[model samples]
Target: MSTSVVENLGPTVQNVPVTEATAAPSALDTGLTLGAVVQTEGTTFTLWAPAAERVELALIADDGSQRNMDLAHTGEFWTGFVPGVGHGQRYGYRVHGPFDPAHGLRFNPSKLLLDPYARAVDGTLDYSSPLIYDSSDGDSAGHVPVGVVVAGSEPPPPISRPVHWGETVIYELHTKGFTKLHPDVPEHQRGTYAGLAHPSVIGYLVDLGITSAELLPIHHFLTEPSIAARGLPNYWGYNSLGYFAPHAPYSSSGSRGEQVAEFKAMVAAFHAAGIEVILDVVYNHTAEGGFDGPTLSFRGIDNRAYYRLGHGGTMYDVTGTGNSVNTAHPQVRRLMMDSLRYWVEEMGVDGFRFDLAVTLIRNERHEVDTVDHPFLAEVAADPVLGRVKLISEPWDIGPFGYQVGNFGTPWSEWNGKFRDSVRDVWRNSSDGVKDLAYRLSGSSDLYGDDGRYPYASINFVTAHDGFTLRDLVSYDHKHNEANHEDNRDGTDDNRSWNCGVEGETDDPAVIALRKRQMANLMSTLILSTGVPMLTAGDECGRTQHGNNNAYCQDSEISWFDWSLPDAWSDHLGLTRRLLALRAAHPVLRQWHYFSGEPVVEGGRKDLSWIAPHGGEMTEADWYDGNLRTLGMFLAGDALRATDAVGNALTDSSFLLALNATAETRQVVVPDASWAPAYEVVLDTSNSMVTEVEAGATVPLAPRCLVLLRAL
Candidate 1:
């Protein structure tokens, strides 16, 4: 997700001497590293622009006085070392080359280009700046923001993710939205990186029982021209500019160089709390959108090498956000890889969730290929990054891009099937039982054949791009008029049910139904056999007033409401209970796909599907479109685990009975042979404790799920 507010353009960077800046590494190493490197004697600025004839570094002083230094060419890299022009120096590149837009060579010496590897960007982009576009006839000297040179520091010691994939509970949250409404965070620190690491915020996440904070994009991003023109912001932050630099706007420190340190401290804090920090990275496209877009870093540096060019030198818009980053190119691919490693090694981030990841694996011909994709193979084989969690969105807006089950091993995919199937089943749609079964079983049909474990599927019911859980059951259609696109921006395939009324209602019965449905969705996500991701504020009934696509609604409509009424206490409590139960039970989260075969001699198999009438699901029952109530029996004897000593782990068998119809249903329990006695462990109907016997029929409330344990 993007940030909404436009950060005001700040003062320019002040020059610092080599004595004040950090000393560079004296050990002979690969000099291929890009960006400005500070040294004890001098600072060396490097730029990789094979297409440019000459690249000049423009150093803007404290008084806005500019000095140009001609860079010496070493192979494809243009390098220049200037004594005393060390850290905190405001700088940008001026490339003089052919400016033929039709052939995609958009190099204009008039527009100062940002360093692609800038470690700290000082100011925000002004889209209205005429010089932002090379096609325009002016220079963009004082209008655009400049990159700051920073003396690199030692990276913090790695503290890898502590939780196993099977036990991972991802919480997707926007950095600003998470802390902007926090009651305890200091006002000055709110909505910043420092605020996110606040003790109160950490305490809430710990209490919510999530392993990783899959934060929205925090990279140096730019506000789009269209979004800025409408006086709206791209709060989602998908439009990234600098991959290596953390978005300075999120930093509370006024010093330009301190953003990197603040980001590292935030990651260190999360690591200390045993919470992994997984960045939502967007490498699919740069902020420099279509051909008509601005002459930012990539477009001005080497448009042909950085972006995929179509017929007549047009951009190959696979991501639907203008142009796709040409990962097929070796230099571009290396830039992405280097950025990922830098976050893990330098910033101490534990993992990454790639946005529109399909674009990264797509071939030069715009075809998705995992087999021979060099980038994919390199990431999966890298020593440092390979150990960290790697999650892919697995698709883009391109043709044949809906590759749900196409990702190779060692990479988990966000399970869109789980979201759709769960929504359909809870909405009581036709033939949803089979679909729900597939999802609850960890979508084995998608990951099983590849020899991947259940953890390969990251299951979830709601995420940032869709309606929040509160709105999912409160609206039948997307209410995104607030997005200001005539309600035509977001997707319309929301399989939601509004209970009895659309939007908010004072009707007690409708409110109750909505609560129950939300509870059902939460319970399913927590109990499903995969890595579950809980959207932030879902546990507390956070809402966007039915605005499913609030990507641009950056006001209170997108921020988390900390003032939830006492009526939502049950909802929060229910989510906590479900998560605790999921953690306590090994059967609920299996590492391996259920074999449906005996684990021990003369014992029942690990899993069994039961019809409402108590028998194993038959062919007719599986095909029944009207079927709403079903039971899943997980034999605890077959559920296996290992302790530190590698001893076998055991737990009580569980029987999950689900009823999605709008009326009470009599769900018959399995025979005594399956379990001589049973006790209801969880009831979404009232979050109450009750017991039932084997072979007995129990009245289950509509849109409720009951978890029973074999006694």
Candidate 2:
């Protein structure tokens, strides 16, 4: 059975893939299971390729032997059941169809395509050769990865207690990089899923007081041909090829299906330590890349049905990668939802942090769909996905892509605004406290009216894409010459200050000032009213050596330097202290936005901004550009929350003071009406914790943050 395709893979969806009369069959109609499903008798391989006239499963033996079996075509799906076949078998598919690229049909029988739903994958793309490209019908069997059959598994062990929304603290880290150089991790396990779940790793997280470990992309991904051709590695793993399979190299147990078991065990370990695992997923695009790239999985199966296409059969490129996924496609949506459920139900992962999430909701016309988009709506309605932590990077590189706070209701967004504002303040480049005030208080202007609370803002100063916190204070500009792109690839608009010296200076005073800036940035991130996300080693002086964009450098530039712990104890200690404070104080991690209204009769405002003088801040103070020294007061009694047992939740009110100016500033504590007295709890200036009398003035050093508790 064959079908004529559209002349061009353009914006129009009507004439794409195949006609609507012969579209891919719905699972509800056929009840046909997809992918290689293991049964007691044999393994059945089912694929959805409506346009293909012939479909064959290419089973590869470990010794490079190959066998091809024809799949029985039925209702737009092809099925092949092989008896005596079970888990650990490596296989791919050969789809025979029209080879017209102009009509979005670039099927080549020679290119052995992987199953999009492969539970595990083996081998990497041989990017050194031109034959890897799907340009001709030349054989690509050995060049691309093959799918490994995963065992039919038992239900994963359930998490006893997941962290609640309001009190959750996120620690983002690259799985391999986080433990690659860890002294305590086993030699073999270092830089694998096993390493991330090592006892010392889990113990460190528990000790640091973070409830969630947000791992960077773990999906089976490919090094871009360009990056790989340049002799650089795709360290970030954002170029996703297999969503169901974990990256093979990061598997210590083996990739012939043991990687699945190892990943499940890793998640279980984290759950046992009272920490939830959050995956950074890239569903926006696949590693198949643009028209001139390789045929991995999605491209060979059904090109037009899987990817968004532009005029003249050109691929619609968003996500700053090559191709934007066809989020409007029903089967594509099903695949995503299935992958998500597989991780949560079978693998026992707690949550997912979607990369370039806005692309996931683009409509058939390639426009943003915020209103009841099928994918997001399905996620919100799914009993499994809805309950877990749902976070979005929230934007793509498409038209009108920077929708930071626009992802409404239950979706927490990476607060890029918070990072910018905090960086500006600590670097003393900010115009005033006006924008910083908005960010420090959860960016109410962004999330307040949308029925969202403070937690919706995932406050982060440094993440995988940018400079580490240490480099944020050390590099005045991005030094990405190591990326091999002549330093022109990374963003030049880094709002970083080098603290009177550039890129690792030996001057003690400059180093000290950089440390203070690091502390100030971290302190603001934690003390701010949001879900604070700490970049892995930000608390312990991790530096990319001025390479803001270290996505391709998998060497020491991207890996965490475990040796910094002993050397930078003060910064690490300060981060731990701030996290402890956030865990203990309900007022700090408020679920509700502050109204600034009185909590009780004749009481002070629930929250207030303070002036240099011992008085409430006037409008002029917020607008003044030179007013770097300021204070934020949170009234503990105004939390208006209760425990599960229904008892009223109340605690001591606190004040956070900031001095970003060059000189020491005196910040006066408010009288007893706001707090009985204030005591320094955590000081970025390395000041000792001390009690301050009511209405007393506390000295704040330059580039320092002081958190004071009510006595």
RMSD of each: 5.5, 5.0
lDDT by residue (1-711, candidate 2, tens digit) is 232111212221111121233655664456666788988877878888888887777778898667776776666888867887899999988888888788898777777889988999998788865656667546776788999998778645766886888989999999889999999999899999999889998999999998999988999998998898799889998999998998989999898999888888898889888998999999999998888888878888899999999887789998778798998988888889889998888888889999999999999999988877888788878998877999999888888788888888869999999989888888888898999998989899998978898899999988988888999889889989999998898888889999888899889999988888888888889989989999889999988899988999889998888899888988888888889988888989888888889877766678999899989889888789988988899988777789999987887889898899998887778887777777788787866448888788777787788888888
TM-score top scorer: 2
Off by over 4 Å in 1: 1-31, 565-567, 687-689
lDDT tens digits by residue: candidate 1, 92-172: 888878877789888788787899988888766777777688777576777677788988787755555477898899999
Residue 208 lDDT (model 2): 95
Model 2 lDDT, residue 622, Cα: 78
The residue pairs that clash in candidate 2, if any, are none
Q: What lDDT score is found at residue 136 in candidate 2?
A: 59
Q: List the residue pairs that clash in candidate 1.
A: 1-236, 1-237, 2-235, 2-236, 2-237, 3-235
The superposed Cα distance between candidate 1 and the true structure at residue 617, in angstroms, equals: 1.0
Best by lDDT: 2
Q: Model 2 — TM-score against the truth? A: 0.95
Note the Cα lDDT for every prediction shown. Answer: 0.84, 0.85
Q: Give the TM-score (vs. native) of candidate 1.
A: 0.94
